[model samples]
Target: MTTAALGPNRTSRLAARRGRQRRWHRNRQPIGLLYVAPFAVLFAMFLVWPTIYGFYLSFTDRNLAGASAPSFVGLANYLEAFADQVVWRSMGNTVWFTVLTTIPLVILPLVVALLVNLNLRGQWFWRLAIFMPFLLASTVVSQIFTWLFNPDLGLINAALGSIGMTGPAWLQDPKTAMTAVVIATVWWTIGFNFLLFLAALQNIPAQIYEAASVDGASAWRQVFLITLPLIRRTVLLVVALQVLASIKVFDQIYQMTGGGPANSTRAILMYVYDTGFSNYRLGYASAISYIFFVIVVVLSLVQVRFFSRKADR
Candidate 1:
C-alpha cells in the first residue's frame, strides 16, 4: 500500500487501542473491588472493625448494665487489671494449663502418629480412632468427660474402686479440675497434631530408612538419627500451634468445671468472659482481652521465629 493509505490505517488502529486501554483503566479497580467486596465487608465487620472498636472500648467505662453513656476512663482499667489478684490467678492458671497440656498434646500425638505410621494391621481403624475425638463438639466432649469424671456412678471411679483405689472428684475438686480439663483438651485436640506429624512422616522417603538399615542402624537408631531430624521442623510447628491453642482454652473447661471449685481451672479467657458478660464490666473485659491479645501477638512472633529457624536450617 502507499504511505498515505498505510498512515490512515495505522492511525485508526492506534485510536482503537487507546480507547480500549482507557476503558480497561476505568474498569479494573471497580471490577476487582466488586469481586473482593464480599470478603472485605465480612472481614471488616467481624474482625477488623470489632478489633478497632474493642480497643477503643478498653479505654472507656463501657459497662453493659450502666444506664449512662460510656465515658472515657483512660488507663484505669489496665491499671486495675495489673493490680487484680484474680487476673493474675487466671493468667497463672492459663499458663499452667498451657504447660501441662502442651507437653502431652505435642508429644503424645507424635508418638501415636509414629506408631500408626508403622503400617499397623488395622491402619484405617487406628487412624480413625485416634482422630475421631477431634471431630467431637466441645460441648459433647465436655459432657462425656463430665460423666466420666463424676465422683459417683462414673466409670472412672468405678474402675478405681475395682482396683481398690478411690478416685478424687475430677471436675469438682480444685486440685483436679484443671487436670481434668487438660485431659479433655488433649483427647479432643491431639488428633490435629497427629495428622500433621503423620503427613510429615509419610512424606519421608523410604530409601532414607533403607539406607539407614543398610548401614546397620537399628530401628530406634533410625528414628533418633534420621526420622526425627527430618521431621524436626514439623515437631516445632506442632509445638507452636499447641502452645497457642492451649493458651486460649475455655470452652471445655467452662462446660466441665464452670471454672470451679474455687476457680482453679479458670483460664484468662474465662475471666474476660465473666468480666464482660456476667459482671457487666465491658471496659475491664476489653482491657483484659486486649492484654491477652498483646501477649498472644508476642507469643506468635516467638513461635514463628522458632518454626522459621528450624525450617531454614
Candidate 2:
C-alpha cells in the first residue's frame, strides 16, 4: 500500500504514457502538414493562383490575341463596365431569373418531398422519377429542351395546337427567351433540392405526426406548424444554394439560347464570356467578373447575417 501510494501502479503508468503518446501524435504539426502537402500544392496551383492572377488582370489591358502587349489601365475597365448599359441589363436579367426560379424551386421540392415521405405507393419509383433529371448532364438537358422548344416541329407547340391554342415562338422571341430559360433551369435543378428536402423530412420523427393526428391537428395544420418549423433550416439552405446557383448560371443557357433573341437572356456570366473570348478583351471581362463577384460577396454576407439572426431566434 505504501509503495502504491509512493508511485503509480505499472498499469496506471502505462495508461498515462499512452495518453501522452496520443497527445504527442496529435500535435505533430509538421507530419500532419506533410500528409496534406500534395493537395495543398495542387489547390494553390489550380485555384488560388488563378484567382489571384485574375484579380491582378482586372487592372490591366490583357489582350487574348498577341497583337498588343499588356499595359496597366488602372480602373479604366471598371469605369467602362460601370457605364455599360449592357452590363446593367445582363445583371437585371440575372436577378429576374433568380426571382422567377427560386420560389417555385424551393416550394415544389418541399411539397414533393413531403408527399413522398408519407410512404406513397411506388416509393422508390417516385424518388427515382423526381431525381432522375438531376443525374442528366446539363448539356444534354439543354439540348433536349432546345429541341422541345423548337418553333416548327417541337412537341410543345403540337400539344398547344391540340388544345386549339397558339404557342408563342418560345425561343425565337425576345419576350419569351428568358422565360424559356427559366423553365428549363427549374426542371433541370429541382431534383437536387427535392432530395435535400426529402432527407430533412425523413429525419423528422414519425411520432410527432401521430401525436398531432391524435390531438386533432389536420394535415395542413401539421405542415404549417410542425413540419415547416422542423425543416426551416433545410428551406433556408435550399434558398441560399438556389440563389447562388441561379446567379452563376451559364452552361444550360449558353447551350440553349446562346444569349440570343436580342440578348434578352444574357446573364452576367455570359457577358463575361463574350467580353473575354469573343471580343478578346480579357482585362475588361476580368473587371466585369470582379464587379459581379463583389455583388455576390455582399449577398452572401447578407444571407449569413439573416441566418444568424434566424438561428438565434
After best superposition, candidate 2 residue 155: deviation in angstroms?
Answer: 0.7
Point out the worst 10-residue segment of candidate 1 by lDDT: 304-313
Where does model 1 exceed 4 Å of error? Answer: 1-30
Clashes of 1: 0
Best by TM-score: 2
Model 1 alpha-carbon miss at residue 75, Å: 1.3
lDDT of 1 by residue, 1-313 (tens): 5998999899999999999989898876667788889999999999999899999999999999999999999999999999999998999999999999999988899999989988889999998988999999999999999999999988889999999999998888998888888888988998899999999999999989889899999989988999999999888878887888889988998899888889798899999999999999999999999999998899888878877776886
lDDT of 1 at 301: 87
lDDT of 2 by residue, 1-313 (tens): 8887857677788899999999998886578888889999999999889788889999999998858789999999999999999999899989998999999999998999999988889989998888888989999999998888988799888899999988889988999988888888888888999999999999999999999999999999999999999999999999999999999989888898898878888899999999999999999999999999899999999999999899788
lDDT of 2 at 287: 94
What would the TM-scores of all predictions be?
Answer: 0.89, 0.91
